[model samples]
Target: MKRFALAAALVVLATVPLWVGSTYYVNIASQILFYAVFALAVNVLAGYAGLVSLGHAGLFGIAAYAAAKIMTSGHGHLAVAAGALAVTLAAAAVFAVLALRGTGLGFVMITVALGQIVWGVAYRWISLTNGDNGITISGRPSPFGLSLASPRGFYWATLAVFLLAVASMAVFVASPFGASVRGTRDQPRRMNALGYHVWMIRFLAFVLSGFWTGVAGLLYLYYNQFVSPQAVTLTASAEALLMVISGGTATLLGPITGAALVVVMKNVASAYIERWNFVLGAIFVAIVVFMPEGLVPGVARLVRRSPLR
Candidate 1:
């Protein structure tokens, strides 16, 4: 049954552009895909490792900015992307080392400070980032002779990447390293006593999280064709975090569901409602109040307890 449901969901996702009947909706779907990836990246640490970070947008923006800077300087699209990922991974390593100095709230605060530093640099680095004007890429990459110039093409490309990322994450979470990370999350002292090297497991998890976040950043840059300090803001990180929490941390589909809700509210709802932010906030509050475990797990729990079941 689960396999059938998964196959059905994939079919629906693959056919979204064909059925949506509008470029705007296709682009929105792309946004949801990349943002869902970002939220999943957050969930890697927050859910699995029990290390909640509030500065992942900084890592996300770093790759976007790196790609933009390289592409604008006449580098090849492939090279620019590779460079962006490399830079993001390096930054993530640094962040992990520093953030791991403290556990729980301390780690969160450290990430916040680190994120602010990135934001300040992006805002003030006018020479490279163009400051408030932002840097815009002139064209999209045509990988393997396939052009992503059209909206449908872009959406397909984004979907492909999203699937690869999801598969990789699924594998990661099922691996021994994933078990170690979860062990560390649930009982660091026990894991440490068992010779698991808790800190190392966490450090690696943080870096892995950064890697996926960087992938999302690269996709965001491609989708928007622009990079700016706005992408690195605290609000962006907070939003991604909210998506993770609202969707149910530790679950594969949770972040994606949350991302869909948040993206729809931000893009579709905002168009029809002037107080969309208020509405989104209210909905988030309701999710917290009613479905404290998150929409996915909460629904699953109810289903399990249902008389019909």
Candidate 2:
């Protein structure tokens, strides 16, 4: 039943460009799709592996820089994809080793420091990053000879890639190694007793998450046709965390919901209100105080208890 519902939802999303036509909202939808993938990356660590990070934006920002730099340097879209993913995964490995050496607040502090380091490099290294000016790439991103020039074209492309990411995450979560990772998350001592390398599992999860995030960054680079230091700030990382926590942990679709919500607030709601940040803060507080499990899971729990099922 859940599978059927998910399929229906995807079908509806796949038809957005066709039904909604090319407009500002369609562009917003594209943002939602890519950002949803980004949120899913955060889900892999915080939701599945019991690891929280405050430096996620750093990883995200670095990947975007890598993609923009590679493409602007006359690399093909294929190279941009491969090189960016590789760079981010390598960075993720380093972050995991440094941040995963501890848990809770210690882990959080390490991640913040690591993320800040990345930001500092981007900010100070004007020769490489062009400093705050950013790298602006020209023309459409044509992968496999298909031009993602038009809004509809890009939207469909984003959907196809988003589905691929979702499929990959689904397979990973259902695999034996994924189960072991979850086991480690729940009971690391017991998992270690079972001869499973707990740290390795967590490391792999971290790297995997980074891979997805890099994919999102690549998409983001072309989506905006620009890259800037603003993309990798601590606030961006916080927004990713908010997406995960506000939507629900340990659930695939929760972060996507959170992403959609945040995008709507940032784009639509903020347009009408002068103090949109205040509104967002209130929502965050409500999520923390009331729906601690996230809006998706909290609503799901409510539905389950209301005799609607």
Candidate 3:
């Protein structure tokens, strides 16, 4: 039944553009998918490794900036993407090293500091990032003779990428290494006594998180055709973390569900309500109070206890 429901959900996601008449809604859906990828990336550390980073947006934005700079310089899409990933991975490695030097609140603080540096550079580096003006891509890529310029084309491409990311994450979280990560999270002393290098596990998971975040960054750049310091802000990182927590950390479906809720609130509800942030804050508080395990796990628990069930 779970598998059937997952398949049905995937089918509905793939066919969203066909049924959703408005281009606006399609774009919103696209945004949700990409952001879901971002949230999933964050979840790798926060959920499985028990490492919550407050600065991953720095890694995410760096990829976009790198890709934008290269693409704007007239490079091919593949080359530009490769450059972006390379830069992002290097930055991620550095971040992991520095942030892992501390644990608990210390780790969180180090990430915040590192993320601030990235945001500062992006905001102040006038020549490369164009400062407040932003860097605009020439256009969407045409890969293997298939153009992604059209709304439907881009939406389908996003779906493909999102699905691939999801499958990859599923494999990662189910593997032996993933189990080691969870072990380190729940019982670091025991794992260390068992000859497991807990720090290495956490480091690898952080880098892996960066890799997925980079992919989401590329998709974001393509979707907006622009990259700016705004994308690198701490707020972005916080929101992604919020999605993971709100949906249910350590669960595959949680980030996606949370992303859908957030994207809808930001895009749809804001249009009708002036004090959307207040409403969103209230919702977050309510989620924390009423569904402390997150919406996904909390609701599942409710369903399992329901008389109808």
Predicted structure with the largest lDDT when compared to the true one: 1
Q: On residues 1-309, what C-alpha lDDT tens digit does candidate 2 reach at each position?
A: 989998899899988987876478899999999999999999999899988888999998889999888888999877888999999999999999999899878888898999888888888899999988888988767677667998888888999999998888889889998798789889999999999998899999999999888888888888998888888888889999898889898788899899998999999999999899999889989987888889998888888889757
Model 1 C-alpha lDDT per residue in residues 221-282, reported as the tens digit of each score: 99999988999999999999999999999999899999999999999999999999999999
lDDT winner between candidates 1 and 2: 1
User: How would you order the candidates by TM-score, starting with the best?
Assistant: 1, 3, 2
Q: Candidate 1: list runs displaced more than 4 Å.
A: none
Per-model TM-score, in order, reads 0.99, 0.96, 0.98
Q: Write down the lDDT of every candidate, Cα atoms only.
A: 0.94, 0.89, 0.93
Ten consecutive residues with minimal summed lDDT in candidate 2? 138-147
Cα RMSD, each candidate: 0.8, 1.4, 0.9
Q: What is the lDDT of residue 12 in candidate 3?
A: 99
